[model samples]
Target: MGKGPGLYSDIGKKARDLLYKDYQADHKFTVTTYTSNGVAITSTGIKKGELLLADVSTELKNNNITTNVKVDTKSTVSCRTI
Candidate 1:
C-alpha cells in the first residue's frame, strides 16, 4: 500500500476508537476528558469506585509510528472525622 494524506490520521482514529471501547467495557464508566495529552475516566457506585487516568502520546515519522500509553488507578477510601 502507498502512503496517502490520511494514512496516519486513519490509524490514529482507529486506535482511539478501539481504546475507548475497551476502556468503557473494562471500567463501566465514561471518559470525562480526552485530549492529545491523556484521558480521565471515573466510576462511582454504592459498593466501591475508582478513578483512572491515562496518558497517551503518539509520534509518527518516516512512515513509522510510536504510541505510549500509561494508566494510573486510584482507589476510593472512606474516612470518618473524629
Candidate 2:
C-alpha cells in the first residue's frame, strides 16, 4: 500500500475534535468588575504571560501540536511557559 498522511495525523485530528466539542459543551467565561469613585471598570486576568501560545496556523501546518507556546511578561521582564 502507498503511504498516506501518517499515524500521528489521525490521532491529532481526533484529539482536536474532542477538545473543540468539549469546549463548546461546557466552556464558560467568568466576568469581574472593579469600581473606584463611582466609576465602573472591568478587567480580567491581564497577566500577559498566562495566555496560551499555540499558533493554530503553525500547528495546522504540521498537523500536530507537540508543544506549548512560550511567552514573555513586561512586569518582571521574564519569559514564562504557557
Candidate 3:
C-alpha cells in the first residue's frame, strides 16, 4: 500500500508491452506426467488455429507432431515436438 502499486499491479502492462507485443498467431501445447515407476512422459505440439470441429477429430492427428525429443534418457524421459 505504501508503494506505487503491488507486485502484480503492472502484470497487464507487462503482458501487453513485453509478452503479447512479440507474440505471433501460433498455437502450441505441451503435457508432462510421470508413470507409476517414475518414468516421465512429455509431449509438445502446435495446433492449427481457426478450424472447424471436424478438423480437430483425432487426439494427436490435429496436433501434427513434427518432431520429438527425448531428454535424460538414463534417468527420465522428456518429449518435445516442433
| Candidate whose TM-score is highest | 3
Per-model TM-score, in order, reads 0.20, 0.25, 0.33
lDDT of each: 0.41, 0.35, 0.48
Write candidate 2's Cα lDDT for 4-82 as tens digits. Answer: 8768657778778877855533322334443343322222233234352221111111233232222223232222222
Tens digits of per-residue lDDT, candidate 3, 1-82, equal 4757557766688667785787677676667665554344565556457631111111221244443445432345444455
Lowest lDDT 10-residue stretch of candidate 3: 52-61
- Considering summed lDDT, which 10 consecutive residues are worst modelled in model 1? 54-63
By TM-score, the better pick of 2 and 3 is: 3
Q: Which candidate is the best by lDDT?
A: 3
Compared with the true structure, model 3 gives a TM-score of 0.33
- Candidate 1: misplaced stretches above 4 Å? 1-4, 7-11, 25-82
Candidate ranking (lDDT, best to worst): 3, 1, 2
- Model 2: per-residue Cα lDDT at residue 15: 73
lDDT of 3: 0.48
